[model samples]
Target: MKSTLKDPEPLLETQWPADPVKPRKAGWGGLKRRLAPYGFVSPTVILMFVLMLVPIVMVIGYSFMNNVIMTKHPKFVGLDNYVTILTDSVFHTALANTLAFTFASVAAHIVLGLLFAMLLNSPLLGTRFKALFRAVYVLPWLFTVAIIAVLWRLLLDPNGVINFLLMNAGIIDSKIEWLSSPGTALFAVTFINIWAGYPFYMVSILAGLQGIPKDLYEAATVDGANNFQRFLHVTLPQLKPIIISMAMLDLIWTSQQFALIWMTTGGGPINVTEMLSTYTYKLAFSQYQFSLASAAAVVILLLSMILAFFYIRHQKARD
Candidate 1:
């Protein structure tokens, strides 16, 4: 027989000592470690379930019904409501407008937020002024959306400061109705949202930016990396998680925006600025098209779910 190496006397046998797992604690010791995190989080879970989960479940149940207003009778119509509302012209209009508003707002939020955060992060800016500017930026968000909408509506009105200034400058002979016209109403609402909403994204992103080590940038500099290159490599990688989270949060907020539209345009002169939220309200309350409105709610809920799903998947994939 060819003297094959004896496999080093079977290293598996040499190395296979007892693969001992530590003993499990009998009770409280194990429980304390496992329960500590849940104990800390339990209040939030209870609150969310009571406030958010219950409401969402109720909404979903109502979405499948044609409810009588006076009697509170919910007749299950299955998918008919969905099909009918989905095919409705006004629903289509609201869908398009809502999407346009959401996309524009979210895009502007991420881009402008990043830009503002970058500026705020700079050593070129004075910290004192930065604090002042940040405070001012946050003021719009501090106000209720309804209040903000009313403020902007007045500012954008014919006799509002905007038109007053323009007319004073002889910019136009006629006063334009910023919230009244079909062309300008939706776009005007979008601008207000962008202005009010961007600060939150900026602040959150700035916080994320702060978490990144200054050493990373220093190392990049040592490697002859330029500002742009360093940002593209180091800053962006650090910001990816925050950006995804911020984008999802913003999408949900922008999609559900109701008070602004209600206060500013009331869904417009001819259903021009009517987003899905306003449209759903009009259907349910105004027209008593309960089933149809429920269907619209379902659509909104589904869209939000899709956004949240993608956000979570993106986060998981990153991990």
Candidate 2:
């Protein structure tokens, strides 16, 4: 008790606080940290090289030479086929038809798809209801194209439902051959393609619409943007990726419209709707010109590659 009579200020209340957050100290480990992302990406790169690179090489090699089914070796033609095919009047016609079909179908699908998407994407629309409607819309996509062709052939027959309706309405006294004429046949095929394909774009673009930030639209409306302006400024820019991608997809799909055109018009009374696929098929199987067919295939390959290349370039340019 007596020893406790020391100075009361002897005890100190020293406080130890946490270290403040500052710039992180760096070292060798941080250097390798930048490389961590590569590990995840390496597998994708390898798969791409294996799947895409090897096939492209094979196609390029096949494009340079000519081969027949009977021959073991494909002889080098030195671009003669390219020159000839380019100058060929029939080839030119086929190419022109293909171009027209591709552009028209793609454009139609874009327009129709946007319209449908707008309707479907409208506010207060029920998801299950929209999906139910879309199920009906996408039925054409699931039908066998050959079966579809046969079905349409029956539907568009001179005495078929369409012509019958038109005739009974006194639209025409005589049944117009729907697929027999060159001009009408192409349009007919394009119609089927549009009906089948537009739904794909519609559903995909509806999804794209869903992903858009809703607040942007709210802010836009608050700024006095009307429906049309909101769509032009907001929706189109956001869906640009989907539009371009779908356009390319359309190109690929419309290019392969074989059974539809073949069954509907069978390259027609004048080869009017003859696309490259049908042309090659006729050449190889029907005409039995194996080498020439191969040559034509090579040409088709190059044209396809050219189209694909331009699309990719366009995408990159947009980017």
Judging by lDDT against the true structure, name the best candidate: 1
Quantify how close model 1 is to the true structure by its C-alpha RMSD in Å. Answer: 10.3
Candidate 2 per-residue lDDT over residues 1-319, each given as its tens digit: 4786767776678888979989877777886797779978989989998998776666556545675455678787777655766677877778788888889999999998888888777766788987777777667768877888888888888889999998889988988777887658888888877876787888888889989999999999999999999999999999998899889868877876677788778877698888888887887789765656656777777767877987888789888
Report RMSD (Å) for each prediction in the order shown: 10.3, 7.1
lDDT of 1 by residue, 10-84 (tens): 445455678889987679988799899999999999999999899778777776777645337667778777788
Give the C-alpha miss distance for residue 27 in model 2, angstroms: 30
Worst 10 residues of 2 by lDDT: 62-71
For all predicted structures, in order, the TM-scores are 0.80, 0.75
